[model samples]
Target chain A: MDTEQQVMDHFEATCRSHGLKLTHQRLEIYRALLQSAEHPSAESLHKQLETRLPTLSLDTVYRTLATFEQLGLVKRVETMSSQARFEAKIEQHHHFFCDQCRQLIDFTWHSFDSMGLPEALMGVGTIRGKNVVVHGVCNDCLEKKKKPE
Target chain B: MDTEQQVMDHFEATCRSHGLKLTHQRLEIYRALLQSAEHPSAESLHKQLETRLPTLSLDTVYRTLATFEQLGLVKRVETMSSQARFEAKIEQHHHFFCDQCRQLIDFTWHSFDSMGLPEALMGVGTIRGKNVVVHGVCNDCLEKKKKPE
Candidate 1:
């Protein structure tokens, strides 16, 4: 089976075991999230799905995504923007965000997992996950600055 | 001179150098940010300043924050909530975010700076700053879970 099919099957089994109904709309939303590697907000996901599923409401999309989040099916990414964006937990990775344009780019590094976590933090509580965000100006914005026109 | 005073002076000098007006309202907004270790949103800041700056409007607070951010006088922290929050660049540090209640707590660790960044990200663009977030259930929430109401 291909990666997408495998992902779908995993979501299906997880949902079934948790007694979550994999309705058509829920599945479509999950598919959209899996396909959106850029990490999409609820409104953006709604816009992308509107053409394909004309009758889909933004609220339903939000509710479904919220459910998925509750079940650990997705991870919400941090952005300077007011909108909360989300990404699928396909694997462990870190994000590079452009402070100028608020663009979030993700990439993985094996070294991060092996880094010694501070004992100070460990004593505070149980850590579920860790994320690092490298912030700077993206190439597009840097180029735009170089050329006024 | 104390650190806060030095920070305020730096902000004033930066504003002057950039030809940005440091009006009374702007200064108050900056003051609020400097005092807020919790990193408050514009509305929260406005509410906090209501007594001393009774005439200040929410829109004006928002506008001032936008100007301060544009001037590099402040940094916006990413929270799970849709309300965008701002923090004064008092110093470099990381955050501990409560996954249960969405509380963001700041703490610093020097080891993160020594970790080598992945070259794949270096190829993407220029990186100026980095922040790490440790996600977990806070002590309060953990206790609540242990005793169950």
Candidate 2:
């Protein structure tokens, strides 16, 4: 099986192992995450999922998203905005945030041999690895600035 | 004048220039932020400032902090944590997050220009400069790991 299929199979088995009921809402949230190219906020996800899960409550969306975050199935995208967004990619990588357009783009560049975190901190919290986020303007934003005054 | 006094004077003057009412709550909040070595959350600031401003409502604390953030007197520290934290040091520098202690330690190795963050990010929502936050285990965590017989 391909990597995507392999991941899905694992997720299915893992959910079963964890005794989490795979409700329609949970499945829809998972599908919405998988389908989105843009890292989507709960509000965005709710809008997308509304077509299928018409009766879905906003609270349910938040709860489902929170559950996926806890399960390590999705990663939260950081923005200066109050609303939270998330991504489905689970691999070790970095992010490029476009300050102008408010876009979060994926960037893959690994520079560290290990986490290089200070040795003094551990057990206080579980930090699995580095989630390096680099902020800058994307190519589109760069082009927009070249327009005449 | 000392560096701290200079910063306070500058901040107070800036507040005046903007016609922002520098109430006791604002000053108390500013003092609390200036005193904190750890990038502290709104709740943390509220707790600290309350000791001085007993009549200060949580709403006032939040509003004062929001104002401080908007006035460029403080910068928001991004984290995966739910609550937002503010950095008192507005100068360009990176942070060393102690995952164990949940503290943000500032590391000023080089100027923002020296970091070489792409110029495209400039002027986009105030890309003051680049900061390389190295997330890792601190020295204390490493010592504890080796202690067990």
Please provide, for model 2 over A1-149, each residue's C-alpha lDDT reduced to its tens digit, 9 standing for 90 to 100: 24767867777776788899888788778877887889998988888888898999889989988888888888876567667889888776666677677787665544432424444332434444555456766667776787735
**lDDT, candidate 1, A1-149, per-residue tens:** 25888889999998999998879898999999988877889999999999889999999988988899888888777777778888776578888988787888888877886777775686667788888888898898899999979
Give the lowest summed-lDDT range of ten residues in model 1 chain B: B113-122
Stretches > 4 Å off in candidate 2: A1-3, A17-23, A112-127, A136-149, B98-102, B108-128, B133-149
The regions of model 1 sitting more than 4 angstroms off are A119-122, A139-149, B144-149
Worst 10 residues of 2 chain A by lDDT: A113-122
Prediction RMSDs, each to the true structure: 2.6, 4.9
Give the CAPRI class of candidate 2.
acceptable
